[model samples]
Target chain A: MTGKLTVVGLGPGSPQQVTPEALAAVAEATDFFGYGPYVDRLDLRPDQRRHASDNREEMSRAAAALTLAAAGGSVCVVSGGDPGVFAMAAAVCEAIEQGPDAWRGIEFAVVPGVTAMLAVAAKAGAPLGHDFCAISLSDNLKPWSVIETRLIAAAGAGFVMAFYNPVSKARPHQLPKAFEILRAHLPGTVPVIFGRAAGRPDEAIRVVPLSEARADMADMATCIIVGSAETRLIARDGNRPLVYSPRSWDAASAGKR
Target chain B: MTGKLTVVGLGPGSPQQVTPEALAAVAEATDFFGYGPYVDRLDLRPDQRRHASDNREEMSRAAAALTLAAAGGSVCVVSGGDPGVFAMAAAVCEAIEQGPDAWRGIEFAVVPGVTAMLAVAAKAGAPLGHDFCAISLSDNLKPWSVIETRLIAAAGAGFVMAFYNPVSKARPHQLPKAFEILRAHLPGTVPVIFGRAAGRPDEAIRVVPLSEARADMADMATCIIVGSAETRLIARDGNRPLVYSPRSWDAASAGKR
Candidate 1:
């Protein structure tokens, strides 16, 4: 059989959140390539091989997966959340673009899954109900300046912000800086949600106002969502407050602008 | 029995894209409620009732669903993509916020699924792999000026844009206008992807440069992704070209800025 490569998302560490399409891709592949924890999520038959690596080794993992597929073995690259959202799909595409000419011919497909932000938003009421943006705070790839610029613009444009890779041991201060920038652009009353390991057994979801949002609230496993100026927090007795941005912004304000 | 309300996403019209969690919710629900087409997507047993409503009647539909759940029925409100993203989740939240006090006691949950933009980006080789924003061009709820402001801010900040509700019968000219505004802020070389009914049998994915992108290329079912300045396109023989925004941005430029 001709070598084929498929990248699929396991979805926020939940077996229930994984789609049939992603599962189908996983079952058909002869080999799996991904970060250790993500790869461990898969239930593989003895005939299938697993190539697990460290989290930061995206480029190398993509190259290795491509090489395996080029050698006529079916390969599956697994990612946590949707493969297209700051994940393996782009890494594989990048590898194919710059790699050997033969690598371009390999059949490839990406099976989308419930990304972390969406899952996180669901756990809350619907902070992402209106316009929103997803930005990864990992400076390992992009500059911190770019992240700052995007955050300001997203807040200025009244788009809800969903942040991935909010904090890590290597980058302890960026999330704080991000919160500071957002506070300047948005009202202090806007809600900030830190969803850790959402959809997983240890999932913890917290909501705080922008004024009280702290860097310590987030870790690498967290996906943080900062509400736009229009985002609302509804009080619910004996339960977590529901947060949602109304579908309609101030129509009167739009007229004035 | 206690009342429960679960909002679930059907995932861009593909049965394969729906998650096990969503399916389980559908199986357990005593009634389904949503827009006509979305409600039609569910395979209901005779005992399971469906309350299909017009697409524009979101508030009423949400109220009706909440009323059912409040009356001790297991209710599931379905949306085409992820319910939290520009879908029914917010509408339900809004209804609960403004409706009867008794509505607060209902158990509520949202099951996230593959959103249209993610499905579209996957088809186009991860155009959203980098920082990105999702906007709706529809002016039915918000003013067009708000959409325009967001377009300019997103483009100026170098964020990829995924547009939902790009064109509809009532709003034919908005998308063309949106393209014009985007063209002003973004380079003409940026790639625009028109993914209609993504992940479904009738899915059609098209890629075009910014200068050549037109309103006719998209419809209401389409999710249009506009790449950032750094987005790349890779060509292949006998296949559609791959489009992806790299994870890394220009670090040198960031330092200068």
Candidate 2:
């Protein structure tokens, strides 16, 4: 039986971020598969099969979704944040392509959603307005050597960075290592915004110095923004705060136009 | 008279990406102001004030929205991507803070929406799954020197980079300059994905080597993604093609115990 797979992005926490298109995709699916925490966001029917697990089981979970889809189920593989940014979209596609012969007839499409970077950027102001990049501190799949190379390049380039998978139960020291690498090139006083569970109920964001940002507080759900030297936090009246990433600033005057 | 300003993200280019909450926000607003190209996407009453203009006029349009909000109008300030990125929310806040006594009392709230970065990331597989940064090449507000600094830092950090406002009428060479800086630290063969008018009818995405990417293509409406060395592209059997950014091959090779 020929089947199809649709990868949907659940967006940042809060139901408000779920687009109508994503909801419609879920409604049309014969089954749903995703990380356990994100699966709870959907309303599943009795006939729908849901394959949910922790992040560690992403590969197996993806394989299972492809298998189900091959068996004639129209499956929606879901992810929190944008499915393409540190989420499950790529994994699912990889699994489908490499899976057994039964999955050959499956059609695939990836639908986009709001990502944590943009969500946190919105919450924290314009820290991402200029050139930026995101890196995961977890070394589970990548060599620390490769990550280090990337970190050095990113820091030297002066691009603002959004860090995902910074720290978790299995790897407690990754974030600190990343911070240390960044400190080599960036000044200690550069602004770094730590966003914990952004868009979730316990959302917390604080601007701290690069040297003072706590590595222990990060997790798969957290997003850390390390700004360029030009990034600044301005405290305005009425408790309105703005983070500005100076895309254009004269080095001689150190003032933005 | 009391008034409020609510900024909404339209989510790339499609109605499917508009969240229920964003729809509700629009329904509740008494006035709406957005980029002229997106004016047709919303259902508005004839009496509602809809302001549209060229992209360069965003700051002025945002100022007008703030003025309307200050004058007892419930206004919805619409941005294509998330308002907090490079959109109108910051401009609105800045205008209100810098304006005369008339705009001091207006209450403002920034709403999150899907961004082009996430859309492009999804289309190009998971180029942003690890660490990444986004920057605008526009020198209208900030200078090229600061942009260079951020680009170098991002490159050194090895974070995936997303570029917004890469080129405009007056700044045609800015994108190439930014590319040159990124090329210095990044590998020559790194994957660079250029998404032109993503999620729109005339959408186009091209994958090119970092060295050969500056072949006279990118423009103001484009969002460019430069993947790290680990990013790879694979062609599927079907008509649909797939892109993959393996966050850490070592983790994937650990073979899911």
Candidate 3:
């Protein structure tokens, strides 16, 4: 029997955000592989088994899952947010490329879901309504210099920036440094949104201007969105403000560079 | 009773891709407003009224929805793909900002769903595995020069780019021109994926090297993803090739500029 491997996104820590297609994929799988927290999010039947590993072991986890699939076991690899966005989908593809040739025959499908940036942007009233870039601030797989270069390029091109892995216990300086670099190119009045655990019970969405934006406002679970020069904020009498980047950009006056 | 306005994403034309939150919002709405095709995607109850308009009439549609919501009608604005990404969420926000102080008093929520780029990336392995940017190639709102500048900047920064609205009957030259500009900055070996109506019945995904990419492969319904310089393709004996951009980058050797 030919085995199958399906990659599914659980959609940013919320049951309501999970799609019917993702749920159906999970229901059809016999085995699941993912980080401990992500795997724990699934309600697997007693007949199904889950192989949970540390978050840093994506490559080995992918390989192990592929091996199980190669042995004719239906397997699913789970990721928080859309699997295509800096998640397990890439790891699985990399594994198939480097692993045994027989693994190539395994049926592969990726079920896309709501990514963190989109979830965060929705809660903040569409700060990503215009052109945008998503960058992971963690320097684990890539160097800080590469991150800096991308940040400068994204900001210079007038794209709103959505940052994943913005701050962690080990990487405390990167987010602050990013803010400094963005301030150099954009106005201090541009809004910076820190959306943490969106769609979860403990969700928090905070909006501040670039001049007063701080690194301490974000954590590993947080997705930070920095607005472009044209981004706007609408303040209400007794409610949280709405932040959004306008869809129209006048080339006659703005962002020729 | 206070009125409520909810914006929901329908998720790339597939009913299975829609989230529970979006469904709930749609069910609760007394009136729906959107582009005709997007509004038609919903199975509305007899009591629910739909106000379908042309695609270019976003501002008027948003204003009409807000007017209904402000007058104590439960309103929903429908968008294909995640509403915040070049969709109705921004239009709603723009309307609220420009319309009236009373519009600010209306309760608002945005329900995020699977975006076209993520759906396209999922269908073609994970081309967005690293830092990436989403740019709309249409010149309806912005000048063609702005799009050109963004393409250059995104290519120079080594970003995988997901292009929305790559080609339309009105704007055929822009996409071809975009390809010409990208070839100057990126290697000809990079992969370009044209994914049309992903998750729908007529979904089509095609992959080609940048040197062989043509604008004819795309349309208004397509999302085009151009892999970064580090992207790789793994061939299979009988299956379609897998394309992905590696999550890791060596700053010492790559994209220092």
Q: Name the candidate that leads on lDDT.
A: 3
lDDT of each: 0.91, 0.76, 0.92
Q: After superposition, how far is residue A184 of candidate 1 from its true place, in Å?
A: 1.4
Q: Candidate 3's error at B5, in angstroms?
A: 0.7
Runs with alpha carbons beyond 4 Å of true place in candidate 2? A100-105, A145-152, A180-189, A209-212, A216-220, A237-240, A250-257, B100-105, B145-157, B176-190, B208-216, B249-257
lDDT of 1 by residue, B35-100 (tens): 999999999999999899998999999999889898999999999999998899999998999998
Which ranges of candidate 1 are over 4 A from the true structure? A251-257, B251-257
lDDT digits (tens) for residues A126-218 of candidate 3: 999989999999999998988998999998889999999999888999999999999898888889999989999999999999999999999
Candidate 3 lDDT tens digits, B1-257 = 56999999999988999999999999999899999999999999999998999989999999999998999999999999999999999999999999989999999999999999999999999999999999989889988888998999999989999999888898889999999999999988899999998898898999999999999998899999999888889898787799998888955435422
DockQ of each: 0.88, 0.51, 0.88
- Share of native interface contacts recovered by each model: 0.93, 0.67, 0.91
Q: For model 3, what is the alpha-carbon lDDT of residue A47?
A: 96
The docking quality of candidate 3, as DockQ, is: 0.88
- True lDDT of residue B5, candidate 1: 97
Q: Any idea what lDDT model 2 has?
A: 0.76
Worst 10 residues of 1 chain B by lDDT: B248-257
lDDT of 3 at B117: 95
